[model samples]
Target: MKANETIIVEEQLSAPISVVWDAITNLNSMKKWFFNNIPSFKSEVGFKTQFNVKSEERNFLHLWEIIEVVPSKKIVYNWKYAEYSGNSLVYFELFENINNTTKIKLTCKITESFSDDIPEFKTESCRGGWNYFIKQNLKNYLENS
Candidate 1:
């Protein structure tokens, strides 16, 4: 079981806090960069959604429930896999910067142990995934839009 690890990824987006906040909270904006198959999403607490992501010939049913929201400042959610053993809390925080930019800090803390047989559940793999989404995808999406 690999559930004691915590991964934190930070990025400075070339957009204001409002823009960054909308990108993370708005379902339409999320589809463009986060997950296109997400049927529904909301920033309000207690909202739950599930979607399947196929990778490496495996089906991962992602379960997410919003746990906290502070408008444009911070949002936290529970992230887990329906068929997996581990559960984690993901926090997205935004800080306004000069020149209409926003600095985002993403923290993923594992609250329960994950099965070790899955390669994607490794700490490094999870870290890489977060970096890819935040650094490559989200950064480019907000910068260009």
Candidate 2:
């Protein structure tokens, strides 16, 4: 895949950078809005975890390995599926905006393309998923709790 094939999702949250950082880095906090089934997660490089996500009656075993971390600022992970051939780098960056709000930029870079036969692996689908998670789910979670 090309470097420009990355899907970026940005959101301005009505919370401090610290709160947003905690929500993204803390395993327990992530389960509330990120992925409910994430068995374990750590903001340290080389840490790895796996979890399952079901969609359209298909189950995807998500394999994640932390590649880089800058506390309260950025985290990057290698994201792939156990049953798929493709791999991607997912980045979560937090910026401190005015008024204590946080600007979160999520970049999903497709390092390798998965099977095109699967709709879930399409770029549009990936973009939509990030939009839903960042703009809707995470926004609601941060604003309400």
Candidate 3:
């Protein structure tokens, strides 16, 4: 509801930071869990990529630009939809936990608000999407791989 809201999802993966970072930064690994059709991705700042995600019969053009990257630690990107006026920042942070476990924190910060009529742009939907990815999808991929 708020103009600038942040959706944060954290998960402890039973893998090392390098593995988790690879999964997040590497395009090949990302396709297995994240956007399967991500055309291209690079960890360098200013790198950009775009992909289309279909939801409820509507196609959303996901526009992403890498803003920052700290090797094996953090990656931040400016995320927006071509069909929407709003934009957001998606941050992935990896923390080395005990016993070879890594803690991954995903933060999606809404820098600008989109129209309320679009349900998918709502904060609740954004939070739910991130939760599903970090808690279920990514978690399963890391643990099972």
Candidate 4:
């Protein structure tokens, strides 16, 4: 984040680490909340996966290559769009509280061409979007299911 150019949004959800981890790692569970057209997905390291993300009128075709996976703890992947040439990294960290609840933290760092594009590739937008999806939608899906 450069000076006042980027926005950082952080959210904490109350759920067991196992449940949250499963929701993220399991392709079936992830599609329910995150992607509407996730034809294929995997959490295995070195695996390449493709998933579709649609929000209302806009559609996004996401291609990701799993870079790292630590069972029951963390997973990191490179996120890139088929239409876009640049790539970013998405990281998921799972922490366990004393009450058996999990504190899941999602950190996304933009490292490609988009980072240089000021108003177009707004960092605040990415932060807010990630916060909403992980804190609100993902929590609801994992807790209610």
Q: What does candidate 3 score on TM?
A: 0.97
lDDT (tens digit, per residue) of candidate 2 on 1-145: 3334788999999999999999999999899999998999889999999999998888899999999999999999999998878989999999999999999999999888778888998878889999999999899999889
**Model 4, residue 87: what's the lDDT?**
65
Write the number of the candidate with greater lDDT, choosing between 2 and 3: 2
Per-residue lDDT, model 4, residue 1, is 30
| lDDT (10s digit) by residue, model 3, range 1-145 | 3557888999999999999999999999999999899999999999999999999888899999999999999999999989878888899999999999999999988888877888888778888999999999999999889
lDDT of each: 0.93, 0.92, 0.91, 0.73
TM-score of candidate 4 to 2 decimals: 0.82
TM-score for each of the candidates: 0.97, 0.95, 0.97, 0.82
lDDT of candidate 2 at residue 103, scale 0 to 100: 97
After superposing candidate 2 on the true structure, give the runs of residues whose Cα lies further than 4 Å from its correct spot: 1-4
**Predicted structure with the largest lDDT when compared to the true one:** 1
